[model samples]
Target chain A: MSASVPTTRLQATADAFLTRFAGIKASLPGDKSLRERAAATVRSKGLPGPREEAWRYTQLRPLTDVTFETPLHADVDAQALLGRLPEIAAPHLVFVDGRFRADLSTASSMVRTGAPSFGSGARPDFDPMVALNTMLAEDGVAISVPHDVDGGTIVLASLATGQNGRAIAFHPRHSVNLADGAKLTLIEIGLGDGVYFHNPVVTVSVAHGASLTHLRLQTESEQAFVLSTVYADVASDGTYDSFQLATGGRLARAEIHATLSGPNAIAHLNAAQLLAGSQHADFTTIVSHDAPNCASRQTVKTVLTGKSRGVFQGKIEVARAAQKTDGYQMNQALLLSPDAEMDSKPQLEIYADDVKCSHGATVGELDAEQLFYLRSRGVPEAEARAMLVRAFLDEALEAITHEAGRAAMETAIAHWWDRQA
Target chain B: MLEIKGLEASIGDKQILRGIDLVVPSGEVHAVMGPNGAGKSTLGYVLSGRAGYEATAGLATFNGADLLDIEPEERAALGLFLAFQYPVELPGVGNANFLRTALNALRRARGEAEMDAPGFLKLARAEMKRLSMPDDMLKRNVNVGFSGGEKKRNEVLQMAILRPKLAILDETDSGLDIDALRIVADGVNALRGPDFSALVITHYQRLLEYIVPDRVHVLVSGRIIRSGGPELALELEANGYAGMVADAA
Candidate 1:
């Protein structure tokens, strides 16, 4: 029996959004033509509800309950908001409430960063959240890595401010273009009070032979909501390495879609989602190999405690032309509480006959043997569990090749553990 | 000093240790020799407070503290150590960090000042050299990809570093080669003094050759069948466990 697309409040939200935002779509980043196309897409697609298979495990009903206001306080100070944010010795940029803070940014001449062109473009049919973010995104950060340049750590920190009485939302658009043979590492960090929602959309274009390392640390406020989307298109022989560390927000999701469009291209999507309290976090990824001789790998680990819930939905699609494609994905979840839960769905859609695509998912609690082993060695029960959880998640964090970025992410993980303790 | 009186333990519904009575005074090393299914490992687990191995009908004490009543870490804090028969492989946890953390935990429990990195490194390096472990082992994850002999040697290295009062070694000699057995035995011997004692559990008497025990006890059907001097180990080694099993039956 086919399930019907039930009428939901999200659909009602779509109607309200179109009625309120149809004419003002030009205020969004991108060209006027692109904005027009995006406006049409939003009007046609709308926000998805639980009726959608992709969003079955996630619900946006809370969004429907409260109206999200665009907090564009242009004069929001960056220095004051930088409390507890460690200073990384590298080129960086900061954004407060999705608006860029030039006074707090440091970039080299080899990199040119700005907002997108006044153009419009359409999103893929997979994600419905992109439509909303695209419809309302502001001062998107754009980076241009010159050809053959080995760019150092380019830190991009986004702070969402919810000091206002009303519920605020920040949709920050990000665009990064890596020229041929260029190499760069990008770190995106999200931080703020949990009273807001931070919805970020990122587009990455890796040209032929280019390599980009993208690391995201989403440690937003535990009371906040974060729904992030990333789209990356890789050319021939290009490498796209991405790692996500999500340990914050009341409800958070890191959605990534990587399309291998050229031969010999590679994409690695790895993440560690650590949640406590009543937090809910999801890592959804779709790796599509449209070109022959491409390779993709994904490894995600989650640890949830209390009444928290963790979800993973990973899909690897191999098209007919993608012969000799090698795709591998693994998702492992560790539930720390009897009330805690984990839902995992790993799918492999292989149309080509000569492709090697495999995926596996596992959900479990901390290993009893390992816990006993540590405890017997004089480690307290709490410390023993913490050590084991960190070890389990460290496997996914090791995917990041950039040294400094990996350390920064580790520090963030330590902070989360400290709070849990 | 360690003492067990009318010690009975069970895993699930089946009783493993029917009734065990043994005693080892301070500074004495005692060896418990037995065949398969004689509950040698269960005795160690019961004393160390491992979950599920319940001491249902017995009184065991270490330094007059109820061994079965406290948590495993508390047992460790009271100067007890168990060199596992199978050392766990903990990937992503550095061996050095684990050792340091354990040492600091023990120190905190003792109300002694914690050892800093330099002091710990000095002690750890000397102990590792005594056990013939590579210096690079500090960089690798704890026991991950280690050979059987290496794991056993690592266990002994831990015992050497932790400086516990009483150590229970469960089949610590099962997989070690002759050279490794010698080095590991020397590591234990180096810790021998008036304040340190050991309960060595093994099937074969071969390990007794390396680390000679002051007292030897034959365990069969969960009860101590015979207790004697060092010659008892040689007797079991020569006659085998068949006679002991039949007699116990």
Candidate 2:
């Protein structure tokens, strides 16, 4: 178990147990060459480990203990498992069991094919997950927006069915490039049931003056395992806002790496994790301010109950040239049961004196006065507690602007509370 | 409407309310004027069934039902309301939503029809106007970032909406300005009726002038030492609780 070893015994076991994706990677109709290149890159470089600062808080021991394989192309009626995802009405790219299903995917008139432009060749040195995803991902959905395009949304859904016996790994790559002055809303939902594993990676690049809203909803089953990574790059004057709602899986980790590469660019990263029973969820993020005047804000909230555990590690770095950069980070956790535990670390590495940077972490229980007030108002004790918990969580959910997507997350939270009750 | 016989309560090991006896009939307002640490707030909290107030001894009955064994929410459903002296501010819970939820909970407990949204809005609007609370308070989180007067007014607003049979005003007048005090008193007076009984806990007699309690009792050293008509409040105001407690001693 050397730190630099790329492939673990578990990953080898997983590879041996499952079948590779059999879809026609060439006939995907959008950026076929780019998909092949990214897949080749990820295959060359395997998963990163604790040596990588971004993956420090979350240990991959649990994932490496079990042998997983590329999931077989199994029959999973998405309608039967999810019971009709509230009609998204926008362009949708659906992947079931790691393979794209064209019949199930509906692309809007706005979806068009074009050469991937943002960061196509300009590669950063530090992020290993990006390299791993680029090298190993078999195929992905590529969405291109023409310069100055505005007001359209794209959704990518990776769904899994537990009927497969062995552990499964899925690398659903997504390359979204926003042209100058173009605005887009992108939502990625990773959902599954039964016993399985999912490794999903999405990369987004915003052009100069472009604005993008990216949201992720991870609500897999308690028996499932997931490791997801999102990479974002913002150009000059571009704005990127991303929110993640993680409330499922036996062991789940969401890693986000964002780079403000241009002056005056802004990024808002927010996430909320609700864990109960023996569940474990982690949100690890890093924001690198490489350009002067760029700004970044990150906030994460975790609520742990039963014997569950949660981890949040956020790092914000301001380079010497990133003068006047404003960076803020806050992580708060609420432990409802004594057995529950939460670990939060907020880090700031600054190389510039003129930059404004601050970080905070808080872990505690539900406010007793708030609880008493709710219960005294006649709400049942359980419902009152749930309402307060929902309120505590609303600060994070409010960041998701998509009506359908936000509603889905809310439903997931409500269902979790109901199950606890 | 409410009766307490030899009520004994403690917090941890220290007894706060020892052998407390009180009775409030329908349509009556009883003002308990006490010196600092006289267990005035303790009595209010004990009646409302707040946790941490261990009732080691005594019987409390509200509307002919045993109150000690019930939970705080059950007490609220039984028409017992405690207007907190320092109301807790809830950041995301809207004031109107809190009121509506509380009202519906009490309604459901009493087998009454729940107030629809429109009806609730109308009632809330009228109550806010009566208390001079801005309509915007409905949109704000419950007492969050509110000034002292606004928090007190919010409590009075709850009293108006819940219409509890036994309303305990716990130091509701402590931090209010003259204008806010008048508004709060007006809200309480508006809720006064033959079916409503109130226990006003205050240090000074200033608020009593506005609501005009029917009786005033002097509470000192966790015991009521003197009982008299409304005039007793003015006397206590003129002489202060020190003189009254010294005279009683």
DockQ (C-alpha based) per candidate is 0.80, 0.65
DockQ value of candidate 2? 0.65
- Writing each residue's lDDT as its tens digit, candidate 2 over B82-169 gives 8999998887688888899889988999999999999999999988887778899999999989999999999988888988888999
What's model 2's lDDT at A82? Answer: 44
Model 1 pairs whose backbones collide: A30-A118, A30-A119, A31-A118, A31-A119, A34-A120, A35-A120, A194-A224
Cα miss at A222, model 2 (Å)?
A: 1.5
**lDDT for each residue of candidate 1 in A1-421, tens digit (9 for 90 to 100):** 3333334566676776665566556565456565455556767777766767998887776666666665756676555568756566778778877777777777567544456321122273335677666666666667778889888678889886665656777677777888999998898888887478788888898989999999898888888889998889999999999999998888888899899999999999999998899899999998999999999999999988899989999999999999999999999998888998899999889899999887888888888888888888898998888789889987798777778888878898888888888
Candidate 1: stretches off by over 4 Å: A1-6, A26-30, A72-74, A77-80, A107-126, B245-249
Tens digit of lDDT per residue, candidate 2, span A121-207?
224233444543443455566776778988577777877877556666665566788889989988878777777777666677898
Docking class of 2: medium
**Following a full C-alpha superposition, what root-mean-square deviation does model 2 have from the true structure?**
3.4
